[model samples]
Target chain A: MTARLGPLFEACGAQHRAALIGYLPAGYPTVDGSRALLQAMLDGGCDLVEVGVPYSDPVLDGPTIQAAAEAALRGGVRLRDVLSVVESIAAAGGRAVVMTYWNPVHRYGVDAFARDLAAAGGLGVITPDLIPDEAQDWLIAAQKHDLDRIFLVAPSSTDQRLASTAAATCGFLYASSLMGVTGARDVVSSTAAELVGRAREYAPGLPIGVGLGVRNSAQAAEVASFADAVIVGSAFVTAAGAGTSGVRALAADLATGVRRPAPQPA
Target chain B: MVGIQPVESSTAVPDARGHFGRYGGRFVPEALIKALDQLTEVYTEARSDPEFTARLNGLLADYTGRPSPITEVPRLSEHAGGALIVLKREDLNHTGSHKINNVLGQALLTQRMGKPRVIAETGAGQHGVATATACALLGLQCVVYMGEVDTERQALNVARMRLLGAEVIPVKTGSRTLKDAINEALRDWVTNVDTTHYLLGTVAGPHPFPVMVRDFHRVIGLEARAQMLARYGRLPDAVAACVGGGSNAIGIFHPFIDDPSVRLVGFEAAGDGVDTGRHAATLFAGEPGMLHGALSYLLQDSDGQTIETHSISAGLDYPGVGPEHSWLKDTGRAEYRPITDAQAMDAFQLLSRTEGIIPAIESAHAVAGALTLGAELGPGALLLVNLSGRGDKDVDTAVKWFDLLEDK
Candidate 1:
């Protein structure tokens, strides 16, 4: 699994395009429904998919994702159900990762979670709340299981923190485009480019995926100009609410946007 | 009765990574790590600085009224089968609760950190009112996030906060309760880490918060111990307090931890009853899980999803308890019991009628537990209960519960 992310990014780089990453809470609305939605996202051109493990309290999520998570939880989705969703996505040849808060993983036992997630064919995990400094248990577990550990870098992160976080991260650096919770915005903050640039200085050649506000195709194209991956969550969650077809259509549109040539310097 | 003696050590809690023996830690986003570090550094410095301690103590004395008296409730104890009951009068504080102690301390820390604004999350509104009062006194901008449902149930407190110049935001998100409000406050802190302070109200969040808030309220036990000794020449056999997020319990229990003869007890709200699955008895009926940045005993289902808790008292209707309390329970240093809503309400009215002291429904849980404990002890047992807050805010709830407002 640790060997999967590099090739995914390199392949996108060869195509002169940014990888399109879509997010959906596992078992949202229903487990089967969510699995099908994730497959639709991949079918519609998403290079990678993030299956969110719904937590009771998601501090970093906005209302859209929070609602989705609540619905998933209401549907009785557990960690095993999440791993099953990832398994289905992997069996279908879709590159999938589990994005979750740290507590669920901690409660599930870090080593057990890593072993099970790897067994389910998960490429890596995106821990929105777990920082590298306090993630020693997870660090050791992920390394032991040969699973990728993706860490988030916020706009507020100091240089020292960014370097340490990047050093510990396995797959890619998740650069939050803004300082606020995860949600869509009409305008992607200019801070995303600055953050990506800063992360690059500390972790040269590492893939930086910009998330937290990239909503539309235009915003995706704008972020794709500098970021190695355009990670959109709330927008996809909003679309997934309508149907799997909606998720597929949005993924296709976002995929095209990421591939569009960066606007010639005006 | 055991004689009161000064506890040997003051700060043994929260090892380097903030774990109270595998319970607490900085399980937060990367964005908040720097803020937590800065807070820990400032708190460490403030803890040792004479000027800081003096200023905080002065404010605690002059503004909030420290050294709250302990009252022996013999009339109430008569109903407890001959046992003597003493009440730690935290309810007599200026802001009407023990929460003021923690808010004032954090507000001072906010000023020391040079932050101009503070954000908090509230459930029953006592913490919100206390935070608003402190922020007003210190001239700091205050924003409080409350669950939309809580805002409606605790309308007076919402108005009180607004009157004190704090902005009250009704969060209409998940569960629409304390947990959601905390989520919003954390988001705000992460977004405005440079200029704002998240003045957490309870001893449940990540490191520094649990330890810092506990230190602020430890004065409760310290003062109570001295007062008990000065008055009765001995320590009470048992100390009890209501546990929502376990602030008041920890406050009164910390100083007595070394007193081997003194039994520390915490009463959690059992909304209907633990058997009915509608209760907030996290330590009693809950399993270990993580929420709001700390791994603690939480009311969760088989899938690790947090179960919505119920209590007549909005303050105690939370699914999680403080991590330190979890550590205490596991170490056999403390015992936690569940009190049903009916039992707590019965004690609420009983205290009012017998002693003319209107206890908050939250505190009444402890009062109810003390009654059972007193009866079990048979006779001559001395129990000190922390009257955590006044019942003024719960009058409407009481009136409705007993149908006092019905045309009579």
Candidate 2:
């Protein structure tokens, strides 16, 4: 339930740090290999693991993540494969969430998908394309199944939408830092700070997680200063291509960045 | 067939969330939702404004040549066992295809919205050329994304688009085909939603696009229906058109959908044959899946990854059909058939020689289907077919296929 995710963020908040969330496609390279990589991320101190459900058309993904998803899809990854990964993460005592575009879930059946994901011990799902206004079926299904429905709030979203999206989201709100698709950037956008600030006005109790271009430790630390969670996706996916050791190294580095101490006042 | 009533109202479609029965919806990223919503609102207002309609109608009439005549081909009819075959000459439109109809309307909308740049994705480059021409006329910056393979196969169209002052981007990802081009265009739209308008070319995509594009081309059916009535004092026994994304077919079919007596037939390109597992026959062989922001019938593997589709005609070489076509198929309001590449080519050459009219390979699929239907209905049966485009773009491919250049 939503209460389960709160403790993880609360634990990080107690340490004066943001939660380190690492993402990797469910069947990257191979399904079993991806599970090993996910375990490495958790071992390296990622607070949460987001297992991507590879889709045919990932409109919101940048080239790096898109290539990884295409490879996973080519390798014959399906909803069942993703669920198996979730089960593995849960068994290892790591909180796992499914990040996917809405179509695959729609095709898989909403209520059935929610029930299966819950049974597999998935905390929730992050539907990148599903907005609060059009999320009635998902809302009902998530409520009935007691699963968290994470919604995305963009820089382009209006205040009314921000409020609605924050209100509807059961888990933390996903705040897209940039206007563009997911990728690593040299500098975090100035708008990300503004978006996080605005999200606070709308959803006071909800934690805001910033994603889309958080690459290195420096960028992660910068975002960690103003956000509750630093989501590193493409960087981890790129590291995943190298092997499990590469994933562990990147995850540890990012985890350290989220825990970096604030500057002492002069 | 199910006993669903034939759709009588044209505006009944797409509700608020853009569902044509169980088919269309906004299955795009959150980044593009605002743009889609803005487009839906602007299009709703633009459709009702007399000034907007006047400008669009004037341009359609004076610039693109509206009311393209219906030409009855008795000579070609001979091959069909004496069925009276009439062609709606959409090929006569400016840019040599029915693609211009949808672009012109969207381009007008772009200008009204104060957007200075327009982006589009194309398969065979007809839609790209059409978009380029509209952008050029409207003094807006134009960019077209096309598959790398399509650029090579349709080099002349690539040249035409560039000549029209549009930038042609060859996409090299994910099979390097229409589907990839669409993904790239969508990415561009999400990044540049403020200054750019994505001029979609067919009756597909997320919400208002399917309804808006279909309305823009509905003139094809309206004009053809009136002309057919005026000429023969009644509607044709059947109306047929090729189905790529189903724009041309929907355009010609919508006006006649209410008339149950008039059968609506759509011909899909079966690259080899449907049974061979290499074709673009989405309605015939595909199951419901999501692609390009719409949940419709698509050629996908068991895991739901889109499968590569094949067709000799680049325009018809797509794995997904428009959501409306899927709805029509499910409702049994329209019937769809598969026309193999060989059958389409046979009809292409037969029409060119018999009637001195070279049809686009995409349209030839419809012609091929009409021939079979004509034979089944026997003599005195009247058939109306939408000649969607000219074959000038396919001449090179034709020469290679028939080995016409080998003699030289």
Candidate 3:
């Protein structure tokens, strides 16, 4: 069954313009704090929220997200705990997805995982390394749960690969802004616009969300201008930690600037 | 219709999701998350492309020597209480171990991705030599990051890799060994992702890698399966191999994962002893923790920091086993037990004396396990051991262990 995610996006008022996406590491301070942070992000105008399933070794994460995961793990946040929190947030009128590595799902059991995650209020799962050819069983399980299995894209992807990812992914496509690990960058990819433009051809009408190192309003605005959605992960995760209000304010401020029309290159 | 095997479904547990019953997951940074996602996208395309699998199999045959033989060691079997002993001789492969299988596959993938440079970290130098060999053959620039201590101990391997045109960088930070070298390699990979490919040595690390490496090494079990059928007419009673990062053992065990009758046993090094506080028996003594980018059984303390490991063999001196092995042990698909340094040394000497095969210290652990089981199983049962590598590079370590280096 095709996931009817477009309506959800439209219902969230993301149809008319680029959606502002925020990311938070689940159980950063505690489960309760993550819930509050997620709520605050939504209230502050985030159209969608991505919750990171804190894992022990975050190889592609920068210092900020890494520290957040360490804190979450220290707080006894297992994969099940993350799913429970997702259910809680969704119960409280929020739309969220899980961003995690592929192992936790394996450990949690794939078919059971998709069902439990769907039951716990997750709309989709974004597993960065579950190569498409290998995803059939899990995808079938995900489809059984009616959960979206989002795919990612980069400048390195060929046209054929982009098409495969687009065909496999649902909910929205996560387009990496850079090739490196997640962290703030000094400059944007000179090819980010082109990458999104190419992905558009592959997925056609799928909503494209760009992320990885978009730490500020300027960067968010630039990304939003190119794609259907702008995803801010490391920056939001760094700022909106357990007890910090700085992240909330920063996210809100960036939220305003992201919706504003970006300046065209000369 | 695809002729499916019964145990095959169990072996591919995560199916496409990359799970090994809850222990295997991607625990990577968010920045590379997207890149990994992109990689999964490309990998999916490659898997279905017939051309990709054909090319991979072709390389395995033409370059790395596909269908590595299964040798029946009647003399050694008699020594191990007359149990039927068969050696899945990965040691006979071009670079003398199963590590080449994964490197060749990754090097091909790197070329397919249009990457130019290959980076790797080595502790015992087998992986470095294999990667360097693959790079030289493929004409890719190879940089091998090795720990300072390991470089000093395995100096000959450094020379070997350098001769193969790989730049050997001695990492000096942290414990100044394999772990540090891995950290440095990851740093290099992150910084140069556009042009460089990291040829991880084992079936550990983040997602896709364990899956990818295991897929490449499947040839080991695949070949053994057919050869064993031809030689013995049916499946064996058990499969035995040494476990460090668990690549060789996984390579052999993965193909037999669905063969419920094939009892899979992984032998880990016990250094001095498992309980004696000096060992690399991660599965025996380690707690569940994170290291080298995945949550696996690790020789780490309460605070999640890695502990120093001791093994008479430099190759087996690591504080962690591969993540998939951790899952395997937990799920009871494989049983991981310990072999003390003395026992391994004894087995190493015995193999040399009995078969004229001076097995690598790491492979000695498997020899020790086979002997332990062979004595129990008697002459009728069959045990397949992955004779992982040749022992020439480990001569100094063996000489010192046996006190044979008094004057020369």
Candidate 4:
């Protein structure tokens, strides 16, 4: 069961720490900004990152995230640019996972992508759209290249599904904190904690990261209590979408958010 | 685990996971994740509650005129070289299409959720018509986004939607067609997640939709099944329908998925020709990829960008089919074949002349398939085809294609 990403998890675990994960749409404002945002996320508080390879249609994303994707596409950010962004992020001492839809992956050739990501500074690849049953070819290639193939688990997953999904999962398990697309919400669901607990039971020892709709410090702190890592996607995307100063301020704000107590005390 | 007992009817319900044989699951972005989760919860409650089902059934029976009759097309059958042909009359429903079936269910669910408005996208305008009809009945503010090109070609449908009190917004982006309309509608839903519900037309999109739409349309097949038994005293040898995002085909095919004795064939439109780059035959020529939020077979370029697709029939001119349809094709549970514009036109004319029944250009694809398959099956075989919609809106196009304007 020992693998490449396992070492990073072990290192973080030994430090008695949690990872602050960030997500940014690749090439949102500009190519340079995309690379700079990755470095900023890591320098501020992010321990690991998810880089979105923008596609024409981003179905699961909320308005803020969708705007970021559209902006990235308009700026001529293709999947190839994402690889270069990962390479630069790695050079600057950051670890990232290319989070993309299956279209770009298929277009680039899965084997070639797996090899390139492994060579770049990427540790894993998470496809939110590909089910475990349909991920065999890519998973095999990812494993061959020593890259973790991460999968998304929702609260709606059945027991039979939970087992099969956990078996094939690598890296930290991604637990969608809510049921809908990515955006800030009024409050996090109480069931999210229970779902994460069930997922942790299924994939024992693997770190569980919760993402989607984790916006401010209060939400982040609450998620941090239950998760090994708290991933803020739309928040980062929304921040990076603003000018460079906004991105930095938002990243710092998120760091502060995660360190604060839960909005509603336990 | 070897011999699992069937769940008791008292306890049995649609899986909480929203799967129909492992094909439907939420595979989407984080932003709308909670919204869909909420929808799933609401839908689950609605599916199990007799009050919901009873009300929906009442709408279908009284308002939509459902349990829509099955007519034995003997004359049409004799023309198909003597194969016994049965037509399920979904075209008789309000709004003149099977699209009403799915919309009615979603509308009821929307009302249950206390949504004040409904949003939808349309291609050939059948879905827009149905959605508009539902909104009018429910008094929900209806807004339909249609591509500019479609609005021009389908002017009457646009007017019909307006008459039904829907605000038809002309989308002018990308290629200005169905795909762009969908993109705009999705953007709308993300922004207005609280007050609005997107009434997806077909058995496609992300998870819950394909499962939900298919469930609502399952009544079509269920009623047809009993009717066939009563009429023929035995099961049909094969079933056929056209595939445009594959909702109508799936509606009729789902109940029979486990029946190995029956063969299901879906026909896609190959405009001009399949090799001419002017066709919408996704299953025939497309590769597996993600589009409009679902992992399915999509007509796209090597760069993963969407490619332009064409079909004489506007409804079948989409670049992607439903994800379940792609899965079914891959698993060989259903076979997909292509029909050209000329052949469909021939079938369109034949059905109208023979039976005094005009069919939608999209449904004409299936009528063309029936002609070929019926001839091959000879005199004794039973074949059921879902006449999904009426061709009134398509009459102008049909007239132009046949050059009947000069004769008239």
lDDT of each: 0.90, 0.90, 0.79, 0.80
lDDT for position B203 in model 3: 83
**Top candidate (DockQ):** 1
lDDT of 1: 0.90
What is the C-alpha DockQ of each candidate?
Answer: 0.68, 0.61, 0.09, 0.20
Candidate 4: true interface contacts recovered: 0.29
lDDT of 1 at A265: 39
- Full-model lDDT, candidate 2: 0.90
- For model 4 the local lDDT of residue B386 reads 86
Residue A6, model 3: Cα distance from true site in angstroms: 4.3
Docking class of 1: medium
Instruction: For model 2, state the Cα shift of residue B134 in Å.
Output: 0.6
Worst 10 residues of 3 chain B by lDDT: B1-10
**Model 4 lDDT, residue B300, Cα:** 85
Indicate whether candidate 1 or candidate 3 has the larger DockQ. 1
Q: Is the docking of candidate 3 incorrect, acceptable, medium or high quality?
A: incorrect
Tens digits of per-residue lDDT, candidate 2, A1-266, equal 46458888888888989999999999998999999999999998899999999987788889999999889887978889999999999988889999988867877888999999999999888989877766788999998887788899888887887988898998799999988898888988888989999999999989889999988888888889889999999999989877999999999898888888334223
On a 0 to 1 DockQ scale, where is model 3?
0.09
Tens digits of per-residue lDDT, candidate 1, B212-310, equal 888888889988988888988999899999999999999899988889899999999999999999899999999998888888999987666778989
| Residue-by-residue lDDT tens digits, candidate 1, A173-254 | 9999988898899988988889999999999878999999887888889889998999999999999877988998999999
